[model samples]
Every structure is written in C-alpha cells, then in structure tokens.
Target chain A: MSAEVELQNVSIAFGNFYAAKNVNVKIGAGEFFSFLGPSGCGKTTLLRAVSGFLEPSQGKVLIDGQDMSGIGPNKRPTSLIFQNLALFPLMSVADNIAFSLEVRGHDKVQRRKRADELLDLVALNGQGDKKVHELSGGQKQRVAIARALAVEPKVLLLDEPLSALDLKLRQKMRTELRAIQQRVGITFIYITHDQGEALTMSDRVGVMNDGELEQVGSCYDVYEAPCTPFVATFVGENNAFYGKVEKVEGVKVKVQTGGSSFIGQAGLGLDKKNYKFKAGDEVIMFVRPEAISLKGNSKKTQNSFSAEVKTIEFEGNLKNIFLRSAEDVDIRFSVPSSSDTSGMEPSKNVSLSFSQDNAVVLPTGALALD
Target chain B: MNSFYKKNGPVIATFFLVAIIFWLVFLIVIPQLYMLDLSFRPNLPPLLRGGPDDVYTLTHYKHFLYGSETSKDAYNYVDIGVFLDTIITAVLVTIINLCFCYPIAFYIAKLATPNTARLLVLALVIPFWINELLRSFAIRILFAGEGVINNILLELGLISTAVNFIALDIALYTGLTYAYILLMIFPLYNALETLDTNQLEAAKDLGSSTVRTHWRIVIPHAKAGIASGSTMVFMLTAGALATPVVLSSPNTYWFTQLIYQWFNMNDNWSRGSAYSIILLVVSVTFVLLMMRLFKVTIGEVVR
Candidate 1:
C-alpha cells in the first residue's frame, strides 16, 4: 500500500524563535507535493520534520495514518536526499546504492542485483562499480536518488537536490525526477525555493511564508489565483495599485483609484472571512503585467486607465513598458515583443484596460498598501 | 618560457637551496656522520692509555655481539644485557601507552560535545606545558609510600605497610607513561578530528548498529591517527632513560639505562654508540612495518 503524510498543527521552535509555526498539511498517497518558499522560510525545516530529523514541539506527525511521534529517522519508512546529496565518497556507485541492503545483511549477489536494477532505473547502467568521486555532478545526483530508492521507502523526501546544479542541468533533472517518481508510483515530497522548479514539477504546491503555510493548491491555482498579497508578489510579477472600495455586487466589487473607479472581482472563498468590500473601505488591486493591454483609444470601460509610457525595455520574448498616469501614479505593462506597439512613442499617453476577472482585490490587512 | 624564467630568475631559488643544504650539513648531517664514525672506532687500548695514538680495533663491537659470561671479552665494559633491557622496556611502555591512550583520544575527538571537547583538549595541554621534571615529581606524590594516596588508602582501610607504592618496575613504567600519555593522545585526537562525521552517520542510517559502524567506518578513518601515535610513543619510550634512573632500582633498569651505563658509568663510548645505532635502526624498522601494515602513506600517519 502507498503512504499518506499528515502534519497536525505542527510547530517547531528553536529556543525563543519559531522555525515553523502551526503547519498543517495532508498529502495523499502517491502525490508529488512540494513545499515552496524562499530561503530560511522553513520549507527545509518542514521537510526535516517530515523526515523525522526534528520533531515538532506541539503536534503529532502521522505517516500513513500512523503516529510518527518519537520515531527516529532510521526507524521511519522515509528516505531523504539531502541538499549536498551526502553520497558515500569512498564507496563505489553500486555499493552506495546497495548500502541499505548490505546493512540489513542481505547476500552480496542479491544486493548487487538490486543495485544494478536501480542503476539502470536511474539510467547509469554499467557504471555502478565506479567511485562516487569519479562521476560528474549530474551523475552524483542520480546516485543519491538511486541510494534513497534502494531502500524501497514508501515516501521520498528531497531537500533542494537540484540547487547545486547549474541552471541547464537543473531544468533537465526536473523532468527526469518527475518521471522517476511516476514510474515508482511513490509519494515524493520535494522542497525548493526556486518558483520555476516548484511550478514545473509538483502536482500540488504549498506556499510557505514566515514559517506559516499561506496556501496549498495545484500549481496553476497557486500562481494564477493567489489568496494574499505575499503570494501574489512571490509567485509571479504583478503591478499593485492602492485604492478604496466604492461599491459591491454579488461577486464583483468596484474600487476607486486616483481620478478613476473600476470594477474588480471579489475575494472568493479565501481564508480571510472579514474581507467584505463596504463603501469607502481601503483595499489594493493586483493586475499582472501581461493581463493589462495598452490601448490607443482613450475609451472608458468597466476597468480601464489612461497613462503615459515612461520607458520601454526589451526582454527577448516580452517588452516591459513602464507607465505613469496623469496623477503621477506608476504602472508597468508587459506586451509580447511581436506586438505592433513597438511603433508607439515614449512619453505619449496611452489607455490600459483588462477584464475584471483578471483583477484580484486584496483586503486591507498587514499586507495592505499605503 | 626561457625569457620568463630569466626575468624572474633562478638565482634567488638557487641561493635559497644552497643555503638550506649548508645549514643542514652544519646542523644535522655532519653530526650524524660524526656519530657514525665514532660507532666504528675501537675502545681505547691499555698500551696507549697515556698517549693519544691508540690503535683501532673491533674489540668493543665483538664483545657487544658475541661475548658470553665465560668469554674473556665478556668482562669488557660492553654489556649486551643492558641494551636488551632498554629495548624490552621501550616496547612494553609503548604498548601500554597505546592501550590506554587510543580510547580516550577517540572519545575526545569523536564523541565529546564541543564544550566538553574544548575542556578536554585544555586539560590535556595543562600537564603538557608544566616542566616535565615537575610533572615527574608530581607523579612521586601519587606513588609515594606514605604520601597522600597511601594516607587515603590507610584511612579507607584498603591496605597495610603503605603497600610499597613505588615497588619494582611499576614505578618506572608509571613515571614514563604519565609523562608520555599526552604525546600519544594529542596526535590521535588530531587525526580522529579530521574524520568526517557524516561517514559514521551514513553507516548507521544504512542499518549498521553503533558497534558495527565503529568497526567499518570509525576504525578505518582513525587508522592513520592510531598508527602515527603508536609509532611516536614507541620511539620515544624506547629511548627514555631518565625515568628508569630516577624511579626504579638497578634490577629494573630499562634499555636506555643500559645504554647510559655503557656510555658513562663504564666509559665505553664505542659500545654506547653501537647501542644508539641499534635503537635508531629498530625504531625506523618498526615505523616502516606499521606504515606497510596500515597501507597508509607515511606522511598521512605521521601528520
């Protein structure tokens, strides 16, 4: 049977400071879940807690519905691939891959056969006898994975395994890792800070901020529909505007900006229950750079603004056009390089518009704008 | 390349080389050569006792190697028994020190916490800096017949007659060992400290228990340290003479005590030089044998 992991209001505090705070997550069997955050945001701490390196101070950790309390790392059915890969440098590749079996007192021939199968699985066939130091960085990465899987662990935990690799190699390994997980049909809990890696490989991504989990959902939901300002800012690029709510409908709210009022979508089923748009209540509106398009005609729409193009920057596939409204409010709009807007002159006033669905209204709280 | 070398020049490097070689000859090589030459000279003959032109002979070396109690030359000053005693004492002291020092060194290096480790290293260095003679005198208090230890034991009713605390060969071994334990431990601790702790953890996580992990991982990593520390202790102990003279009676004289007897007490410089050469050869041979057995480079073991 496959394994499911659950962390029940877990909190890990170091002396007077909390490294992870009340983290609760339920990962289903055979799911490729990822904990995504910037460095020191406790993603690795959470992964370590799952792997039984550090116990939570206030809650229970359950694996496959069994309490993992007081269990040591070696006693757990989880195998972790450390950030440095932690390969046995003195041992040959095959011996390293066969270590778990060898320790369990299996026959040498049996351990060798299993090690060979795992080597072939990781696509390092016929190179098992070579020492770990004799291999390239990418090959060492594969060896680490092979060693972790040789134990036939129900859950595999990887802590930033690709952080040491160059960018091209990292990208290539991401696909290989996902394929290996699918082939094995085991639960893979990955930890990483690079948003691209989290988005590209994880079946579900959990965003962590300040030691607390902000949101957990599919890659698209977490990226396209961020629940808070931190999620919006961290997941992707966005242009923020501070304004006050002017009116409210069933699922739509109208916010008033400098010299302009526009309709936007209301927060939908988000965690903050107090997020109701009463008239004159201050809030912030988030619009992605690509969502807002530059228009030549100055026509009024449900959500539209008139601004001047301050500067234009070419970024290979896209152009970043900085804009400022007549009231001196700054805005940025991104357009595809192939757009005919390349002929537009700088410092000229242009109209910008986007559908209300593309606008996300963030409630005024700790993350509220000035 | 020739132009580059000419610009930076080889004169400075050549000058440094010649200077080092000259210093070595004056300080080390020349003295060693003189010692070798002295080992070959015969003992002073009675006919030239009042003159400087003594005839050279192999009488001293011959007596040292082949003389027996009944042989006429056995009455000569060279006593093979003395050299044999020094070699045996040196070997016994080396073995004893190794047996006691290795475990403590391993614990300090591999097991103690950081604060405890610092304190242990500090504790080891304290006695090391105290004058060796003062340290040996301190050992007298511990082994004194009616000193503090005997007094405490009497109060505890553990023995009678003070137990002759410094009795027999025990005193010599105790004094020499107390003085040399740190020498054996410090090198071993340094070597064990360089070992990567990750190897041990990896071994344990792979399923080997604590004891098995030590045998497979910790022991192998500490092999260089053990070999080096043992060799140093062996060499130093083999050549030690002061402890036997100060702490033991003539019946328990060590090999170096015998070497001293030949050189000074009996005025036999030729035989003493021969004994010194033998000690040097034996120390070098043992070091080489250990290096070969451990399959480690000599540099790794020593450092």
Candidate 2:
C-alpha cells in the first residue's frame, strides 16, 4: 500500500536557476513527511520531481528502490493534490473521484462502486452526486482528497492543498489530512509554507531555503534543535541575538551581542555545527520565544538579557511582547495571558531569560528578513 | 430605459438615445422591415417590378419547397436541397475549423514558451488583417490546377496528374476553414488560457493520459470558447457570400449563391429576401441552440 521514496542528489533547473539543487531525502514507507519552506523555496519543485511532473536535471528519484527515469506522472505510482485542489469542475463528485478508474475503461457500475467506497473513506458518503462547484470549500477539499486516494497511489503528494482554506478550516483539515493518511497508510509527502501545519501533521519535517534542504528532522528536532540559523529562525518564532562567539567551554558557548553576553549550548545540536566555530567567530544564537521568560534581574538562568518593552500584542491566550535590546536589536517573546494582565508599560525595561539547553548557537547563515 | 436615463444625466443620455434610434431606424429596423415587405411580394421582371400593380404573396416561399424529387419543374428540389446542403457544408466547415484550431489554440495557450507563443499569436493574427475576400482569392489560386499545391504534389510524385481541386468544393471548405481559423482559435485560446494548468497536471498525476486529460478536462473547461467559436464560425460559413463565389465552379452551388442569383441574375428580390431571412433565422437558431447545448448564457458567449 505504500512505497519508500529516495531522492538522490536531485537537481531541477530552469535556465541558469536551479529550482531544486542537490536535494537528497529518504522518505520511509507510510511515513508522513513535510517540506516546510517559504514561497518560491523549491519545496513544490522537489515534490514535482518526486511525482514525475518534473525531471531532475541531475541524479534520480527512486520509488520502492526502482529507478523512475523517463516515467511520466500518469505512469508513476503517485498522485498530487494541487494547491488549488484542481478538481474537475464539470464532473460530479462521484465522477471526479472515479476518474482514474473511468479512464482505465472500467464500467460505470464498478467505477461508481469504487467512487462510493472512496467517498465513504473521506466521510463524504452519499454526497457523490453533487457537482464540484456545489460543494463547500471544505467539502471540495475532502472530494479532492478522495479523488487522489481513489487512484490508490503508493505515494500521495500534496502541494499546499489546504493553503486556500480559512485559518480555522486549514487547522481542521491539517488534523483530518493526518488522520486520513494514517487510515490509508500511504507515504504522504506534504509541501507547505505554514510552519504550524507542517509541525502538527508531519512525522518528519524538512525545512528548505533557496532550493536547499536546510535540515530534516522531527518537529521537536527542528524546533528544539535546529541545525542552521535559517532553520532555527524559519521553522518557528525564534528570539535571535546577532553576535560573535566569545568563548567555547565544552558544551556551552558564550555569545556577545547587544552590549550583553549570553551563554547557550555550543555549535548547533550535538555540538556539531555545519561549519566549524571558534572564539571570536561570527554566530547567531537562537532561542524560541516560548523558551524565554520575563523574570527580570532575579532570573536564575545563565542566558538572560535586559530589553525595553516596545510593544505588546495580545493574541487570545498568549501575549507577544516585542522588546528592543540595548544595541537596538529587536526581540520578541510570547507569554500565556489567561486574564487581563496588569500593565507592562512600553519603554519599561524587562529581563528575558532562557536556559542554555533551550538555545542553539550556530554559525550564521541566511535569516528570514520578512 | 429609465435606469439608463438615471445613470447618465438627461442631455448625454438623450443624445445616445437619439444616436441609437438613428442607427436602429435607418440602418437596421427600416431596412429589415423593408426586406420583410419585399419577401412577401412576387418576383417579377425589373420592367414589371416596383409598380403599384405589383402583387404581394407567399409565392416565393412556396416556390422554394413545392416540387417533389420526380418533378421536372425548374428550381424543383433545388431550394430545399440547397438550403440543407448549405447547412451541412457550414457544419462541416465549422468542424474542420475546430479540428484545425484546437491543437493550435492549446499549444499557444498551454504548451508554447513565451517567445514562441507570442510568435504564434502574431502568425495567427497577421493574416486576418488582410481582407477576407483577398484571402479567399488566395485559396482559389492555391487550389487551381496549375497552382502551388498541385505543383508541389506533382513534383513530389504524390500524384501523376494535376488534381482539379477546384472542381469539387474543396476550395470553399479550405477557404472557409482558413478564413475563420482565428475566430475559432482566439476564443478557444482565451478560454483555454484561463484554465488552471494545475488541473491538467492533477489529471495526469491521477492516472489520466494526455488525450484523456484533454477529453475530460481541457475541452470541458473550454466549452464556452468552443460554443462561441463554433457559433460564430458556423454562422459566418453558412452566410458566407464571397468565399463560395470566388472559389466555386458551375457545379458548386452554395445557398448564398442561389440568393445572389435571385437578387442579381434573375432580378427576384422577393426570393432573395426570403432566402436572406431564412439564413438569418437559421444562424440565430444555431447560435441559440449552441448556447443552450453548452449551458452558456448569451452574456457568456459575448464575453
């Protein structure tokens, strides 16, 4: 029911620009994997490469250990749910779901039967007779999912399939998509820019930037222990401090920035930085906003800094407090606000602290500016 | 009418209303009413016609369909057969235009690169700038016995003798198909261009081959374009006067030619007007039928 996909040094180019460059990933059978990146970062390009819509400029894609050169998308054991869903507007729900079967010359009875089964699988039973336009957005999403599943593809590729939905619907579909993948037990490769969806649904996430896989790991691995500044900053909200490595003491390295020195775990996770770092080497230290606390000078953590509370954004249960460092570097941290909290006035100094274990020190790479 | 008057103030609105009234009365309404008047009168010789003594009747309409297959009467079975044949030929021409333009439209809309697509658009459009009469004349030259096509075929050893292509209505079919190709392609291109390419890719990814993708998806998405294109091309071809006359021999009798002869050669304005009315009725009916069949509103086609 599932197939392992191995992308060996895949590269896709358009003229002089490589949309995907030297990409390598080994997705396990039935595993839910996600490529998380910003727009135009080549995650979709890599997915197209796996789906055989795009041929790799160099290297090859192997499914279940079989080389797939010269194979087209129709012949490949893969189905792609496009960003727009791309449902056939002319076909009824049943016909759309049974399109794969119908094209293979199956009789109406058999195709309808298969379509009904898929409709049931997507929890859309008996709603197979409606046109695609008649269905609601969420219903259409389910219909698209059912159509892809009806093909019985070994690998299901989703290209930001839920991006068009409302926030609440997108969140709801994330859970539903994961559950559906679990039920079908097929290898699902999802591509998305929304970090929340990727982290919530993927068993392992590959964070990409500029056509390169910055890091590939579990949600916890990507958040708790990012391998690059790009991954650390891009994957989630990270409170960063631009600085140079002051000293490396075994597992701990002290970074000097914003007229303050903070100590964090040295050289990425496992103390293995992608590039070697030494004292006085330029580095960026990243710690999650949630990891930083508002315990002023009385904080016990070794990693602490004083910043002016520039702004406070109250977001439901959490409140984001934007801070300006002594060197004017902006930092942000969020705290749970169950009630109408008392004033933390703007321009008031606040001490933020995080444990050394919760922070990562890596040689600086690309930073997400926007 | 009141809303239109309200939208634009009285002066400008009234001016436009007067302009439209002038157009309707002078160019359309009066001419059509006069033609209707003419259609009900008998076809008399020019010396005897247009006088107060001339009589009004449906004799012209009856004369078109009165005779049986065995009748030895002149104009016997010709009008009905000619009308039917004209419809059939127009349908064939429309079909040929569709077949020829579908791939070109799809290629320009979906497959061609930007530069090549631009070039293709120019190629499809530039010829349409010349007069259609000239284009039809060019087709006549091409299909002539000693023409470029015959010469090429003879030199290539494809045929032993020069094929008399003009003897048949090959000239009309070829000329009409070529003449309205842009009409077919532009609308189809416009429709197919708006299609989400991901839909095609999704079909292919979902186990549909290239042909199946077009059959199930592309064609359906381009339905409005096809409907509009077919309606325009069919109407044009059916009502075409120049192409058939320029390309036809004695044997190639297009319905338009019959109408032309009624008005010019025979000085039968009544029959000519009746035939013109029929052609108008048929084209309008076909347009409506196409719109209904494609489930498109007139607004959709006009758009």
Number of the top candidate by lDDT?
Answer: 2
Candidate 1 CAPRI assessment class: acceptable
Query: B1-303, model 2: which lDDT tens digit per residue?
Result: 899989999999999999999998999999999888999987676787778758888777777767534577766576788888889889999999999999999999999999999999998889989998999889999999999999999999999999988887787789888978888999999999999998988888888878999999999889889988998899888988888889877776789988999899988788899889888887798779867876898877777
On DockQ, the candidate that comes out on top is 2
Model 2, total clashes: 0
Local accuracy of candidate 1 as per-residue lDDT tens digits, A259-360: 888787765435634257788888878888888876533244347778888898999999898888876778888888888785557888887887788888
- What lDDT tens digits, residue by residue, belong to model 2 across residues A1-370? 9999999999999999999889888999999999999999999999988999889999999999999999999999999998899999889999999999988899999999999999998888999999999988999999999999888999999999998899999999999999999999999999999999999999999999999988888999888888888888888788778899888888788889868888888645433453456889888888888888866523456777778888899898899889887789888888898633365689888766888777788877788756
Per-residue lDDT of A289 in model 2 = 84
The residue-by-residue lDDT of candidate 1 on B1-303, one tens digit each, is 456446657886667667889999988899777666667776675675536655455555666677644776634344556666666677778778877887888899888988998898898788778777677677776777878877898999988668664665566788887778887898878877877775665555455577777676666767777777777777887777666667765566566766687789988777777767777887788779768877878888756
Give the distance in Å from residue B214's predicted Cα in candidate 2 to where it truly belongs: 1.9
